[model samples]
Target: MSRYAILLGAFAVAVMVAGGPSFSQEPGQKGPLVVIVNISNPINQLSAEELEKIYLGKRGFWEWGKPIKMVDLVEEDMNENKSARAIFSAMYMDKSLPALKSYWIRAIFSGKGQPPLVFGRREDVVNYVSQNMEAIGYVRMGELGADNVKSIKILMDNKP
Candidate 1:
């Protein structure tokens, strides 16, 4: 088995011993969302401003010249109270769901760029990021387990 599988198994055991996993957090809390990329990706960190620009389609390529491929989780519903999508949107995109949708609509209408590929499941997002060297995506902290993907720190205020 791969090292990641072993680590993931250990984590599962620890969670079970600690009374199972708890996904809940207080309202307005941040940090539960993690950004991930293919293990081959050389980038280990990104600033909040850079991430926002990438998601907004203002940035197109990595510093090393690879075209960035972004993946996104589908909003659960109109009321995405505290989902990963909600947290990522509020923190990185700085827009509500409706506003982000409108931004994408305009972007596409003007042939500027298309939104990231959307996946309904966190596992799918992780899998895609792992498979594509240029891909980046976000997931709940607990959802990352694949050996082929690695989470990079998001620098806020120029600090990681």
Candidate 2:
């Protein structure tokens, strides 16, 4: 009886120490959406400005091909925040939620780029990312796995 109790305690301790699964996440918790591209894509590394330019149509063509289709989540997307923040911060701008509307408006009116094809939920974004070869989109980071989609590293503010 004492041995069983000790084993149970040890298991509990392991759970507590390991923090669950391959990535650190609480049970039932999810992460913000992430912007992912294909692994085979010619573009390996990009500055936020470069990413912004690509999304905004300021820059066209992936290194290996002509213009690639950029996917945007719809207005109601739940995973939009993280993706936006990652993109905007790369552009050296703030990504407060309120500012996003204005950003889209500017992009639309100026004809610099089109707003992303918005989706209702993270699952939709994930589905889209997994299926489309030319598609690049975002989903909650924690939600990503070794699925069909390949993730590109977004340049954090000043980090290399």
Candidate 3:
């Protein structure tokens, strides 16, 4: 009985110490969305400006001379976590999704740029990024696993 009590106390202490970083979380409890990129991409980090340029086609090529590829989920097919899309639009694009769509349409018609390669689902985007070296995109925190893709710490306004 005494040995069991001691083991239980130690287990409780361990749990209390480790609760800060959960190994996994359900959808609602998960952390913020993260910008994901291929494992071989040279970029280890990103800022809002760099992300904007790459996705907007203002930045055509990576530093290593590889063309930058932006993968995307279509607007209507966004995740159930609506706030994640909202945060992305608010951060990367000043305009709402509809306005951004219009902007892309104009860009395409003018031959100024092309919209990102679109996928129908988040997992498809993740799988594509995992397979392509120059690809970049955003995914919800809950979906980030030990895939071939990785997250670039997005520092906005010098804040992580």
Name the runs in model 1 displaced over 4 angstroms: 1-31, 75-79, 158-160
Global lDDT of model 2: 0.59
Lowest lDDT 10-residue stretch of candidate 3: 20-29
Give the whole-model CA lDDT for all candidates, comma-separated: 0.83, 0.59, 0.73
- TM-score for every candidate vs. truth? 0.77, 0.58, 0.72
| lDDT string, candidate 3, 58-104, tens digits | 99888888888887654353343354444566567555666667888
- Residue 137's lDDT in candidate 3: 84
Q: Which digits, one per residue and each the tens of the lDDT, describe model 1 over residues 1-160?
A: 9999999999988976875323456554344889999999999999998999899999999999989999988744424546676668877866777788899999999999999999977889989998999999998777787999999999889523
Candidate number that wins on lDDT, 1 or 2: 1
| Ten contiguous residues with the weakest lDDT in model 1 | 20-29
Compute the lDDT for candidate 3. 0.73
Instruction: Name the TM-score of candidate 3.
Output: 0.72
Instruction: Return the number of clashes found in candidate 3.
Output: 0
What order do you get sorting by lDDT, best first? 1, 3, 2
